[model samples]
Target: MATELEECFHYFGYGNHLSNIHLHNKNALKVGIGKLVGYELHFGDFPASSSAKNCWKGGLASIQEKPGSVVWGVIWKMNQTDLEKLDRQVMGYRAKDVTVEKVDGGLISCRVYQLSEYIPAAPSTKYKRLMVDGAVENSLPNDYISKLVAIEDNGQTGAVDATLVDSEETKKTVTNGDGVHTSKAIHQSEGYFLYFAYGSNINSKRFSVSCPTSQKVAVGCLKEFCLEFAIKEQTSGEKFVGATIESRLNASTWGVVWRVDLTELPKLDRQEHIKEKFYEPVDVSVDLENGESVICRTYRVLQPYSPFPPSVLYKSVIVIGAEEHALPAAYIETLRSLPEGPEHTVGPMKSYYLEATKN
Candidate 1:
């Protein structure tokens, strides 16, 4: 019987390329010592280890490291059967879970932590200084401060991409001391509004490359909603629920909200792929400081055309930094009461829109 790792490699056209098959006790931990045999390795996150470097070579191998380990890497050559086996094994691994997909004429696999196994760690405060990368330095527009805040607070790792950051010279020419005004001008003279985003975009720096003027709002509640969306073939057709920030009477969610200029709304709309006939904007009340309230527009799929049933969509709002505050129990229960879709019904999916509840 082929091992799981072997099966995964084969399914993705790497079966023959894999040879050395090595498996360590799932819980073993040593810097480099372990079973070595026909195993193929891929290195990420762990850079300096010799074992990680050996993975690039297609063959059998062993590595020795520390004892009483909590993570193990499975190395092997795989065919279709082997890939399937690996898939099953990966699903069983608690600390990390992975799925494979075909992309750009090749198979790619992504590994991430399972929700139950994920633990929030202390946030990093160190700012990355730009030294050698000219492209990166040139992209830091005057608004880079806000962009930096977004990136740091969101826990994103990586240098600011050129597409997102403008050069210092550009910043000097664009702003007359006001960052928001420069952003507004670029957004084309439209009224500014806030957009609350919790998921992938939380790494605000990355998100800012796409929306430079957005701000990291400090108030809101995290709401989990069953949203039927698809990413590049990587997600394996699994409909995942995403958390969004909302406002409630007793508590609020924390999240990054973009103070977007109206002119840029059209571009954002295009990016979100919102169409008038398929979606509509609805008003949502958000908690403000000092016992005040602000209404914001959030887009939801209209009746009949949505893909998933409401029961699966649990709405939990995020309060930007307040991960401790639980969303209203009533809101979660209410989501459970929503109806499910009709046996995988298909139609044009509804997209979201931006609406300003205030002037």
Candidate 2:
């Protein structure tokens, strides 16, 4: 009598998981070695839980495409049920398939896990040790092992690198796709987006009125940029300094990081008047106070105008947020000292948008 066979899944374990100990836990069948082309490795966004700090430090290991780059890892075969169980262990990561070249010179396709977005961050000493040990255990390459050792220095310096291959010597981070220092608009999955608010929107009460689903995540800092109130109301001439990212290496801007549900994105977009007229949505990758960086959607105006101080209500909203987030005390005082307004005009204008949502 003939017997039926169970369907199996194929994958390439590139990170610490390459250790046979982890594979045994997952009950995955270890195949042979495989080499992936046109991709490189980097430490991505922070790990799923802060409690796992000793494991990932700041970011988890991930792969991104880079011309003339390659990564070597163990190939494996696993049953469907086991694959599902393994997915739960790797939260905040998605598996994508790529064609790899086997050690025997055969090309085959396999799945690899990666973060939703690529962020430049350093990995923990423990995480790097696992990878280094796994690489030697699997005999990846002498140069590759050296590259893994250098990563320990990075975590100590708190500097991010473009790739883990060690040849590029990438000193600075490239936040946007165009490889230029300009405004960018980050797009996330349907459930949520990381929205960056540097103006009145930084205030939780005010921001919630426009986006009820918003949840404050962290206090963010953007490098090479400073706050400005260049845009003003055409009719009343009331000024409210929205966020404008100007190029000044020594300058920095503080803002709030909020997770806005995708369901409320449309309403918030319209409220911001993002019709390419005033305060258009932009994408930026900002570093948080906790030594992690993230991609967020922000706003900036297209036209440039002379600077003016923000109004009383406007400055008050910003100060309130700055204090609530416990941003540096000096920064909070700076916001309080900004020239405030004609309550006669600013009060009514603030009412138009600053009203709190009804409970």
Candidate 3:
């Protein structure tokens, strides 16, 4: 008598589970790229009750039904024994039966697991890499793969409690599509805008004093602009100084990009003394370290005077901010090597701002 063969079922994988090397290691066989309709991929954590809750940091990929949405992933052919291996490997996900469309337009009933208790969050960089690698291996669409690459991750290696993540109210962060987060706002009729600061405002502490909503996102380079201490200020019965950017060939001004709420525009304008006409906000494209360029609002001295060295305290602030953002070493060295202007008597307002920036 012939023995009965075990039945096999299809499995849809949208995240790291698409990795054939990993899937095969777990005794599962890969089919090919498949599509699921009415579902979208999101990052979230495992439920508290699951032993695997501690596996993923920040967030992991999971599917949720959204009308008119599509999720692309790999399909796997696995039997009941392989299914047990998959369940053990994916700790917090509960298996759900769904219909997926293969490349040939054939519909197959598949098993996909989603986090049992979904909490919106970001994934870790390593976790994201696995998903991207698997997507590439399975020949997913480039546009769909780009979306996977755009998912932000928590800057961690292991799963962490959501409470431990910084609250959005405290510091708003926006992704630059390269896994970097920044915060700060510039003047817009209404809505958040990116602000590029290459001067003393590069200092987060100083920028926060004026634009409290500002959060440093990514370090960006303003090409064809030279950083100069040419913004002359008259106070304390003497010549004071600030930094500015001037158009120059083959020049690059490195600074921080901040995403800020529109409500902080007035505060930023006042800090930059827009009414005084000391500096003018200009729209410029800034190239980020991640090989992407963004248009940002930055300030240029309205009438830049001859080069003047900044005060020791002021120069220190710029240098500190540069170092904090890990700007080019040569640039930081140049800033440190520059001569300091004559010291001006510190005033009450200057003292207040200096103190505010210390925090």
- Using lDDT, give the best candidate's number: 3
Each model's TM-score, in the order given?
0.27, 0.45, 0.45
lDDT at 99 for candidate 2?
A: 90
Candidate with better TM-score, 1 vs 3: 3
Error of 2 at 258 (Å): 0.5
- TM-score result, candidate 1: 0.27
Q: What order do candidates take by lDDT, descending?
A: 3, 2, 1
CA deviation > 4 Å runs, candidate 1: 1-190, 198-203, 222-254, 276-279, 305-359
- lDDT tens digits, residues 229-271, model 1? 2211112343322222211122333334446655555555433
C-alpha lDDT score of every prediction, in listed order: 0.30, 0.64, 0.70
Q: What is the lDDT of residue 234 in candidate 2?
A: 38
lDDT of 2 by residue, 1-359 (tens): 43223466678888767663232233676778878899998786653452222224455778889999988888888776667666655656778888989988998778788776545677654456557656755667667666776774243311123233122112222233211122223243357878888877887888877888888889998765577775545334544445455433356788899988767776776666554244555556688988998978886653434565666667777788787788878778878778765454443336743553212
RMSD in angstroms, all models? 22.2, 16.8, 17.7
For model 3, how does the per-residue alpha-carbon lDDT over 276-357 read when each residue is reduced to its tens digit? 5455565567889889988787766545356778777777788888888899999999888988875562222366347534
Which 10 successive residues of model 2 have the least lDDT summed? 165-174
